[model samples]
Target chain A: MDKTTGIRKRAWLLMFVVVALVTATCGNGADDTTTTAAAAATTTTAAAAATTTTAAAAATTAAESMTVAKVAVLVPEEPTDFGWNQQGVEGAVAAADAAGIESEVAGGLGYDAPTATLRQLAETSDLMFAHASGFATAAKEVAVETGVPVVVWGSPDDREPGLAAFVSTSAQEGGYLAGILAARTTQTGQLGIVISADDFNWTRHSGGFIEGACSIDPTIDIELVQIGEGGYADVEGGARVTAILIAGGADVILGNGDGSSFGMIRAVETEDPPAGADKVWFIDVIGDKTSIDTENILLSSILWDFQPTYLQAIRDVEAGTFGDVNYDLNLATNGIALLRTENISDELWAEIQTARDGIVDGSISVPAADTRAAAEQLLGCGA
Target chain B: MFDETLITAVLVGAIAASVPLMLAGIGELISERAGVLNIGLEGMMLMGAYGGFWVAIETESIWLGFIGGAAAGALASLVMVFLCVRWGLDQIVVGIGVLLGAEGLTSLLDAATFADTRPRIGITARLDIPGLSDIPVAGRVVFGEPYMVYVTLLAVAVAGWVLWKTPWGLAIRATGERPEAVDAAGVNVVVVRSLAVLSAGVFGGLGGAYLSLVSAGNFIPMMTGGRGFMAIVLAMLARGRPLLLAAGALLFGFATAGTTALQLVGVEVRPEIVNSLPFAVVLAALVLLGRNEFLPSALALPYVRGER
Candidate 1:
């Protein structure tokens, strides 16, 4: 009977430990709530402190006052890949340099790594720039915890409340420009597009390119290929797919993948030139390709400059005027531009310029591929 | 698109994917044949990849970067050897520790060295053999390859020959099968086992170099993507035979290539689902093969001079 009683007591103790563990796990959500509340309290206290200081300073009207704020820029990949992430790094550096603000830059923070790094930086920085769509979730979570504003780059979507704003170049306009270039350059009447994947972003660009090209010549054939599994990282896969397209008589090719575009460029570089022909033309995305000298290749590029948008956001943050709406930097805002060199014919240049003017003057509004309505209406395909 | 060219594409993808696995598998085969199971193959490959990529980026030469990667793998292996062989630690535990340490070290060092640095080495163009490259799909699949691919094939051939047709191979196998007998024959069992482990490290490191320098041309954290462990699986499936391992590696490569190809044909499968195919296939193979028991006798056993 005594042994049975001892066993029952031990069993009760084991149950208590299990309950404690379960409670601890459940308490994590409660702790998060408390942290947010604490952050809100701190924010209120800081506002009150600022109000008192301003009131006190009103008595000493002759005193000059200055405030210094620290800003941080975070990137998801290397800054020198001559592609996606590089643009963000360059933009942040240029903006910070111009404003003469003390800033720190962190790059190559993988999917979840950005949240931890951003949280650590939040303790010191007055504002943070989260520079990738993949980094948006973590940036939003950290912004809520720290009660600080975060400015993210990429097409605006359903973002958290603290995401002050989003800045992005109009991808559809860029695609339209690429289509105009491809239509003019194609000798076989068929232009090929090798994208990184079949994501909404790539589909928008490809759809716009196709529509723009067909607008110029209804019978023009446009073959769209995607390195579906590679996800913008597979250069070899891109090269192989590009080679196959070129072999299938695609005279002009346009690449929409960031780093994977290098593969397409290489494929064009290695292809044997026709007798008496100088080179084949290829269109570039994200950054300028006019500088890369390859015989008759690298004809034009669509350049997305984040400098103006990023600087404006920083200025707004410093002035304490951050807001929730996205700062759309479309072609109308001079955020996206079509860059062509003397290598392109003057006649073709005039044609592209007409479309550019039309976009800027609000005569043309390029639809994005994010919404079902836009995809169905613009792409003529149901989601 | 579904004509004879499709066959060529499949073959080419298989060969390309098999190169890294072949290198790492042959190394693991030798290491396991010597009775030291090194599960840190993946981590070691990652280290080599980052090291090779950084060196090549700084030196602007792929060859130097390849050497740097091999050295890095060897250094990582040396740590495993010290823990398992010298300190008499548990082989599996030591390997797990090494794997974790190498992974952490690679990520930390990659962040420190290559962060915000855009470093790329020009792809080594295909080597065209005069008449051989003109023959249908076989020509494009086999003849049109980078120099590293040729080296991998040669390494596999050489490894097979060395393991099955050499006296040193016999001694090494004997040490694994019966360390007492080999020690009684006056062979320095420690030296042979250490050399086997180090050679395995070199092969794994080369696999990493191929990934960082040749494949991606830039270092991404954890970029080996479990290829090292996959190589070990290939080694096991082949029963330590280099030629069979090559075949196994090609099977994995084809699975990956096919998954990508299917999506390109507008098969509308979620990418995450496709990515999981190769791993799932490997797990199934392991379970099925485990039931049949086609493993080396002394595969995971560590050698002790006088123990049973």
Candidate 2:
């Protein structure tokens, strides 16, 4: 019996050694990974801290450095596209130039590409602006990896530590403006707003436009068409849908899709005018007719100035106080503006100007409609 | 809303869309005909797009971008050749590896290259054949195109003629059909197959270059957007005949253009559903084509000397 017990004990001891060997191997492997992660985190923190210090020192020693601050702007589309992406590019370039910073612009890069670009800029540039919400993931990853403060425009994610801050314009307000334009311009009493499906940003714009138009003229018939569920690269679908709306007698059209907007513009341009009647008008989003060079067709545009917000976030980054929260740029802050042009009659222009002044003076407080309740309150609608 | 102009638009759009697919399909056909199946065409095309765009942006020359794209594709294919030929790795797994690797590399490189520099090329100006351009719908469809469209057509014609008429083509067919016989005939089958795969890489690269340098005039990650796979499907549909490949490519292009046109005309159909029609058609075609036994007998078999 003792011999059998001894053998069992030996077997147990052997099993323990085997288990210990396996445990040691796994623990060592995990330790290696954790160490590398920790090292990366430390390096990133150091780099970020260094950047902050350098910025502060540069401010103090402005005369000594004599080197202009450099800002890098990354966009998801060509800067000259005359749209939302273009506006960001233009604003960033103008802002950087005005601030005496050397500005560089990159376009046609997706989320992953911008991250690497941001990292490279973080090493040298005073500020880096990732100019699209699509770049949020890449920007966040790179910012954390490189410990660089990245300022993203149109991004909703405010949780990352290295993310300097987001500069968001009221897309809802822009939508409301589009609605007002459509409502005022439509003679057929039928207007249509074509949105590129259910993006939160597009939804806000579409919802706000619908609300604002309904508020102005409750009897005006409004048709809301959502084109394609997948994200906004479908220009053909946009064109097709716009044609349908035109067939249905929508005299004025508003579109919030990026490249898809070009299709809508094309549809209207090619549409045959009703005999002896005025041609249909379009309200452009993010840019005006000046960018696209089409004035007769486009009535006006809703524009955003991202410079003030971008600069503010850069300042925070330099101060080493980058926070996680949405920085609201509303009509009151001169962040949003409606383009003024001769095409708009003096009477209509005066009315829009009055509304603008009211918004600025807080008399007509356009309730910030980020939520469903806010949207309802702003539009004074029961939904 | 559906008129002669719409029909013309569909025709033009189809021809335009066929350029990328034709280039990639012809390349893939050459590779497959040489007994090497490369599923890395997608990744290679993406790398080529970015490389071409970057080169064009830097040099302000579209031709330079095209060359850069070709080089990038060649480099990418070299990786595949090394794995499959040198290491004797499984071609499918190696292809998947190559696809993933190329994607990651292109994404990283694209960011590094384009960061803070938005470089764009002007759209290819339409070339109008004075007499032909006056023919209304047909004129717009046939005469109104950039030089690249003509090149794509010329490429298909030349590839078809070469594959059927040349001694090199015979050797390639021999290599793909019965490698043992070709090896006994004193031809280095491996070398011929590698060259075919490399040529395919070049064509795939050019296709990608065309996308960024001519078609879109800019680069985006994954911008090849499965055109490479679509090209492979086209090749399968055409059964490796270049002329038939061109027709199949045009069909796909039409489907794509039709879907887009229909959406533009406000057909109230869900965009998602409409967008998927082209892929569905391709799948259906594959099912129908699968019954035909036209594939090269030795296709996908690694040529090992002295193995029974």
Candidate 3:
């Protein structure tokens, strides 16, 4: 409008250009990428001139999304955990194979805060699956910084649309099934739920169990206890708590602790039966550890398969719906199911199948509970 | 609900939870008294757990496993001995490095060997006292425990006597309180401190072995679960008293057991409150009962012979 105003505006525009150039050059590990990306963008814009506006937009979108060549999976523990870590590594490999892409497993990274490893993996990976809930924050950080898509666990809200996605499991439905089985098979009618942590997944599953057990028989002695805040590897705590529960009229135990489940199994193996109970039985969760159960105490496990979940995540990336859509592995999709162990008899499995059918058909409604009180209420207990 | 079986269960569980903390605390207290604050107790315990579990499974003898566990702990502590005592490195830093190294090493070794099979060892056989084991509810819980339990209890008495009544104990106390003075007196402060740390490693290892063989019947990675840190805290609170440290450990154990009991009995408490109950009690004790007077004067300070 005015001569001085025009001069000021021109100066500001020059400053902005300078700042952009400085940023493109100064950003750590992003300088070369920035230059290459800018050249590609110029080429794309030129190509778009001859195409329809909608087709141009679609092409631009396609160009922006990475052609995922290799996916890397990071876990807090070794894959030999026989539970979460093992399942996660196996799932990542399976998904990579299905998508005809390469997969790298970086497991046993520990539970401390992460970012260094995520950055290292991002150097070679198009997609990274951070297999622990604790790794979500670090994964999101790396995703935003590197423009590499990442899949994290437990936190759907942390999804950054195109950058990060999350996977949730139908743990409650599987938990409900476990409860019904426990109630049906229990000779003493005293079932105990042992959790290593006060995790949302544990609560969801434990609550489902309480609901199912109560449905079978109201006023059933359902003892619930947690080892610690997150004692995922507190094997002694698992054994100690389970032994106490067994002593306190609990013949059937629903145990949910990753590495700690072995302790529960140990207690079942060694401890004598309580006065009213004939034998001790352990129902587990996540990946099946039945192969390692030398004693036939492992009754069942509400399996949480991440293979389908990871594969779906890969497909969503290809479809350009990456973080825009959330994924849930549920009984409805056969993602979560009860592992039929030899300890579970034919008659029991038949009844379980009937329940499974009911759940699938919507005849049985398994309520979602992410809290202890809510789980208690679901079990018909006045919390 | 408060029947004999339930009472017995709670008490027995409490004992099981307390033993490792107690043994580790006592060991830490001895080290703290000698001026070397070993922060790698968690790592040492882990190594012991692995070593103990492996030996016990291989030998089918739980007693030998305890020995293996203790030896492993002592071996792990040699790093602390070399770095802190011999080379005059920062005690806290060395301790942390030891912990990280031990955790990584044990986990790597464990995964390499037994991660697939997940083998479990038989429980250590329990021993029952003649008349004392016949009491109503606390009978088996108090007197009829595994041989290691009695040994641990005896260890407390022996450690107390050694700490206050013996020349070596006096030397350890003097080294912690006044390393310069002890060195001047030709007591060999480094030797005393090294031995104290080694003792701590043995006890920490034994505690870890007890966890794998007697408590859980198997070893799991990072299964020590910061109990070694808790032991260090208990040591600080106990103020050079082995029996008091054991009491503090038991108090922590009881609080943890109470949380479980309350949950099992369907007590209507907030999940956050229930989860934090044990830690809350420990903190409350630390605030209320943990007097800071008797801490070793030169706890983590590396003694530099003639330096002021």
Candidate 4:
């Protein structure tokens, strides 16, 4: 081969090596890109973009003078998951619609460092919500880089004075209610908590569930199995762990995750009921799957409504009070509530309502366990 | 806490989980035994999964779904054959490109089609070996499984025999170890390498299909979850031996299910430690058993007719 040809081949090989290394280190999933149609179809103009930048820079409290024009959300997976991603995207959309603003959604970004996507989204957005906990550090970095106000999850300490904020949820309240429902309905006196990861939302929800189940029957057998440290998209692991929990005599299962929860639902729909139970019931969190529950095994879900939180964030950004305090979504604000399906009996539903009122009225206290060890202690299975 | 029923369930799950790894590993073993390093196996598997899921949804036939999956994988491999094998392009670059393309296409297709409804397939039927399935815990654990499991085991045996006991097998081995010698011996190195890559695609496709059709009973974006990479590692650890590849895959499967088993029985260890158990086992196995194993000398190098 000629000298030029040989040099070209070596250069090409080096380029390939770099691409392979990046892809490997970034981990597997769909590539991170934007849906331009989704972002561009909205009625956003240069005036709105200018107002957002001025408000972010001035940090002024003139809420009436500054108008929030456009907001965007970044999710690690597709919003169609009917779980965390979907809820976050829907919340952004709803908040934008409520404030008469445009909304942009950048989904399927995977778990890679979304510096590029975030920078692209910030060019047109007045505010951004980094939906996944995995995206927190990247979101903070990009917020400082692009001068766009960003919201993240479970990192209150990382919030900047004006650039970044965080959203926290009292999901355990909803979990406690679901636990009461499960404890009342379970035939085998066993409950299963299948966590796709040791996420903050999942850990707190599990702790509340164990406490609530025990409130009804202190001797209830509650088994918690984590699929993996980061099995959020591990559908097979979700199914396998759920099946094992079922075999261990858990009739009512509380499942947490994004796409992996679908696998848990599949396991419930397919696996035969344990020895004493005639049917298996699944309680989900963050999003409702009643529409897609083909086999009707879905009993309820600890629904999370981020619309109010997102809307308030937009308002705070306009008022120059962004990042002053973390946004909290709880049962009292109707941000966190339990779904009541037809599968639940009227009498049981009434009892659940009373419990809900008690929780809202300060007559009940739900334990908040934000870690696996804390959750296990609540379950009386601490190491 | 460790009852017969729980033990039986764990064993069954381990076998079910191992099937995909074994299928993909054995296929990769064949490809590596030839002169090609199939880095795009993950991409091929993802394409197969998408094809299998789309076909299964449209046709409502599991058999056709599997066929569609295999065809899709082969179709993806044809890209590698044309680029790396025929044109003698850089295999690593082409493989990574194929993987990225597959991920984007599958995710986009899934979002457009099933993101709204999220339709799920019904329960897959398990085949019970008539007499053996009735023999208590061992019977159910060993004899009852999806039919694909048996087919995969048979494939492992066939792969082993073909790689060791056939004239064509020697050609494949020789091509990997010394492509120039194979070309001089009138074996048509290009054709042999192409066939090996195509086989890898077919096997990888079936593995992906088994995952969507039997294991998860539905397709999620990126649902293969790095199993393709795991298969590649197993294939490397096996050193071109199909039987050893199968064993390594099974070990991974058991280790995965065993983590859950340990947690289910209330083992007082940290989850981090329990989760790392599988990797520790694999590393230990590699250190002890794979110490002397070596990859083919000519693997991953594009063969040129007149070049050294």
Candidate 5:
């Protein structure tokens, strides 16, 4: 209320943030580390104004930090579409529940300035999960100002000890498995990769897919096309590109997009198969659309489940090592996986499992491709 | 690679993609010519998409869906009419509000109804032109297209005729150039602008309906994906020429399909640059042609009846 009181509150807040950072960065996920940080946060909150100096000194100790009781996740869309936004929101909620904390979903925030929402969520939330890659900049700033540990995406370099952590999808492994499935399933020996955007994640998938497909038969024709620079939601564009891919004699299609995946599926549905093929098959990336696959063309999906990854982030905070790790969703970690449906026969599933095991065991090295050129090099496209 | 079948398919795909932009662009050109710069075309299209999808699903009639979509978009334009046209508010701000409002409302309605079903519409049956439909390649693509494609072309032609060959066209142009002069001429400037904006909304809505019912087969959130903005750019670059607007929209569509063609044939190029080729090439052509100079002088300015 008064100037001195306001100054004391500010000093107390600073002490808590510094203490949390120091404790988190120094300790491990041991019993003592959790107790020390939790106790420090509890003690500082109890008498922040009266003992600001003591609290500041206490916070510097390796074991002293704040207890995160609640976590909040922000997304640009509602979690009902069973896709990226839905998966992110649901994963955050699941992670919070696993971490024994309260979860707040700030969904449907739109692709705009999220500084206001991040700030508001930071006030009450201990760790803010900025789900969308678009929220990375604003979330990092909010974390610094509010002392909240924020999880952002796109750049692993953005991770700061006790402040912000980056999470990215390791789609290469799943892409490899998808490639294997396509190679084994396709009667025509032609595979398609329809990318909805100029995304590095998809490039990685393309690389792995091409490698896996070529590994089966070196001369297998692989057609790949991109919708546009930012065609994440370009459903019509996805459909049209997919049709072109089909026309190029691709019977097995691997589609990577958010909403555009549905269009790819639709294109596959409308298109009659080429010679030596019975029906067109589509392999989707990220989130399963098995429920909406009325045409029965969906073979599988490269699923990215962020719950375990998010839970590990909470565990890092508990051990005072939140921002020390670049969280990844990979096949080895079961973060990235291939979806199975009735379309995948039992024998194919067993074969796919063997490949998955190989990837996890490090026996099969699925090289990462972060660009179309790199992917073409790996897949031998145009070579 | 450029075989007749592939070329036909590519051309057909380009037409499907360009139809929506053509409708939205020609409508935007009329509105800008009448002095109202609408940034809410995206919202109008989005709302129209939902309206059309819902009606089509309910009635199992694609035509009804188109009409419903246009009506919904025109209805949504009432906000612009009352705010910018009547009360003379900031056109850009009101346009943004309308966009946001449409997004929220459509998303909410969709979640409530279609979230579970995720209903998809198949391509509507083509309106086969008697003998024209039998021709090779071009026949199936041009004459075998659904009725909406013909209506879109007719709408553009009609818009051009009204804008260039009618007294109303003179009044609309005069309103954009010198609204005070149009008022002195005893023609209500507000009424002209209102009609222009309303027509734009109608065109945008119909385009959205086609996008959902025929192009995509379903409505997804933000399905328009800045196409309304692209239409705005096309309209500005067309220099008030409807045919040029159609050409610009088709050029963009072909450029998009070209990326697919290049990649499918195993062309080893930067896919990122390839993906952006449509906008980059279209905008470059517009700049080379010096068409942006034709932008309406009084665009985005809210005119009070008596004030300068």
Candidate 6:
């Protein structure tokens, strides 16, 4: 080989090696921060082990010393989703504000194992809320390793004495209300349920919606379409899928997705209604999107307010009983409520309010369907 | 159980879905023909989607959004050209880096810019052909698409003709096949490949903007949703033929919309099976049509003058 060619090859090799080393160095620096936090947590655990004479005394000491100066939440999507992520962030912030403490949010983390992020947030925060069911396992591991308390969703069995807590929402109750509203509002006698995934919250909500619609009209058609297994942000998929349901004669759409709901709303706004209906209506879940409802097609939303439950978690932490009990959000607890919109008439609103009262007063029960099969059964799809 | 409206909707949805894939596949076909295997096409599409949506929201013009998206994609392709084509970096590694970088940057930008008030633009205008648009079922499916679809088809035809008919096309193919021979023949190999990659970026960017502007009418994080990778597969399967790429893209689109139609018709199959229908269709198509398909000899290889 020529000398110049050999030198050029060697220079390229050296450049690659240098770049690799720089990347490794940066990666190790971040690792060191996590390692230091883990080590500190181990030291604190050992110190706690050495000092306590009894469990009662230890609990007392923890209650007195554990200061919740700041709380943090981790969500899988951007906090502006106006759904699960936004509600989680706003709830944590509200809880912190209620306690006169600071709140830190680490959002758009995706559905990956955020172990490093958990440790980083744990370093500066007193309590961490992993705001997604997908995050439960990793959050629990990080909570145990870092000696920081974590709150996970839909994992009641993961709750420990002080390390991890579990919280859940009965979004189905609100979905039942939405179903009632949809049943009342639909002119085509058909409703659509579009879920982005086979999510626990979505299935339960769908089940409740089916039951509610059936309660008002036994033969009301409810067509449920799942966009994909993990189509949480698939806006186009959401739009086309909703279009299919609309073409099948569904005029009211009970749309459940993080960002894909916007697509459903868009379809409802843009598409022509089915044969008998004059307009298509959209029913959203989690957060309210009335501000962005420029088309005025949003009938209502099954609103979820996490503030009460998050505040209770904070109170539990302060009382040294953080993970001792699991939290459940229900209509009775005021954790979930149906949003009132101008599209609903006074008489229909009165009927929805009565249904809500019945649910809270133990006269009505929203069926819990946590799986696709169970939800389909509730809709009589099996029949 | 499929009624007229349902049939029309499925057909319309299928065609709408195919447009982005066809545009991206055609672009990737051009790049592959020039011997630059762009594994970073997904990133370019994503950046285009973001850039396009941002421009559309700001200027309130969908056409300007498409242009902005193409420019953003071209801007992204410069990285691939500089690092892989010129500097001879590992194409796969650089492409993967581009994908990761685009995903993170777009997500961050969307959160930072539109977190408070998520904005959505109106759908683009459709050019319904006066005569064809009045026909039963076929009219809406063929003639009722946005004007961009026609432009994309025209672009595909032009690209195919240029790749086969023009001297510039010969230079691009020669660069991919025999860079040394091209260099000996007084053609700048790097320039040819760079131009090909830039064209790919524009195409991919246009596809992404179509998703955000024409299809969804909104920008969401990771909104391209693996369509970029799907385009890569279509391009590869098409074997450098633009027309075949269009067919493969339409096949995928039809399968996607057909799955929804089946579910809506109360076809009580497992969702896993239903969702896999599109991919199964592609796999079947690949098996049937992808016989003796050959890629460029120097594809993904960095060409340095006077070096093996």
- Candidate whose lDDT is highest: 6
Candidate 4: which pairs clash? none
Model 1 global lDDT (CA atoms, 0 to 1): 0.69
Error of 2 at A319 (Å): 17
The clash count for each model shown is 0, 9, 1, 0, 2, 0
Taking the candidates in order, what DockQ does each have? 0.19, 0.06, 0.47, 0.44, 0.42, 0.47
lDDT of 2 by residue, A1-383 (tens): 99999999999999999999988865674466423432344354546664543333323332122233777888876554556677787877887776766788887675446656666665566557787777776765555554445676545554444344676667667666667767787878767667765655566666667666776787776555655564354444455456456545667887767656655665565443322237777766776644443336777777777777766665555555554455665566666777766568888777777766765676754444454333334332443
Model 6 CAPRI rating: acceptable
Over 4 Å off in model 3, which ranges? A1-60, A63-67, A110-112, A137-147, A155-164, A321-324, A381-383, B86-89, B128-135, B178-188, B266-293, B301-308
User: Which model is ahead, 1 or 2, in terms of TM-score?
Assistant: 1
Models ranked on lDDT: 6, 4, 3, 5, 1, 2
By summed lDDT, the worst window of 10 consecutive residues in model 1 chain A runs over A59-68
Q: Per-residue lDDT for B95-186 in model 1, tens only?
A: 88888998888878865776544445665567788789657768866777777888889999998888889977777777667667788999
Output the better candidate (2/5) by TM-score: 5
Q: Write the per-residue lDDT of candidate 4 for residues A1-383, one digit (tens) a residue.
A: 69999999999999999999977744432232332322221112223553444433433232224456899999988888889999989988998999889999999887886878987887678789998887888886666555567899847787665778888898889989999999999999999999998898999899989888888998899999998878898887888888888877889999998888977887787665878899999999999889888788999999999999999999988887787778888999889999999999999999999999999998999978999878988885331
Tens digits of per-residue lDDT for model 1 on A1-383?
99999999999999999999987855663466534432443344446563433322231221112122667888876564566767777777677777887677887775557777987777666667898777777775555545556786544663333334666556778777777777877777777777776555566667667666766777776666666544575555566566555544566777777667765676666543322234556777767645444344787776677777777777766554554456755667666767777768998999988988887786866666653224334432221
Model 1, position B148: C-alpha lDDT score: 84
DockQ of 4: 0.44
Docking quality tier of model 5: acceptable
- For model 2 chain B, give the 10-residue run with minimal summed lDDT: B115-124
lDDT of 5 by residue, B188-249 (tens): 98899999999888988988887887776778878888888888888877867788889888
Per-residue CA lDDT of model 5 for A1-383, tens digit only, reads: 59999999999999999999878854542345424444444445545462433433443333127577888999886666667887888788999998889999997787688999987786677788898878898887556544578899758778777777898877899998899899998988889898877677888899889888877778888867888777777888888888777766689999988777767777787654766899999998878888777678889898989999999988887788877788889997888999998988899888889999998999999878888768767755435
The C-alpha local distance difference test score for the whole of candidate 6 amounts to 0.83
lDDT of 4 by residue, B186-287 (tens): 999999999999988988888888778777767888888888877887888788889998888887777777778888766644546744554566677767
Model 4 chain A: lowest-lDDT 10 consecutive positions: A37-46
Count steric clashes of candidate 5: 2
- Compose the digit string of candidate 6's lDDT tens values, residues A123-214: 78888999998889988767766667889985678887777789887878988898899999999999999999889889988998988888
How accurate is chain B of model 3, given as a TM-score from 0 to 1? 0.93
Report the number of the highest-TM-score candidate: 6
Model 1 misses residue B161 by how many Å? 1.9
For residues A25-95, what per-residue lDDT tens digits would candidate 3 score against the true structure?
A: 54543345533433333344446453333333433364356677889999998787778888889988998
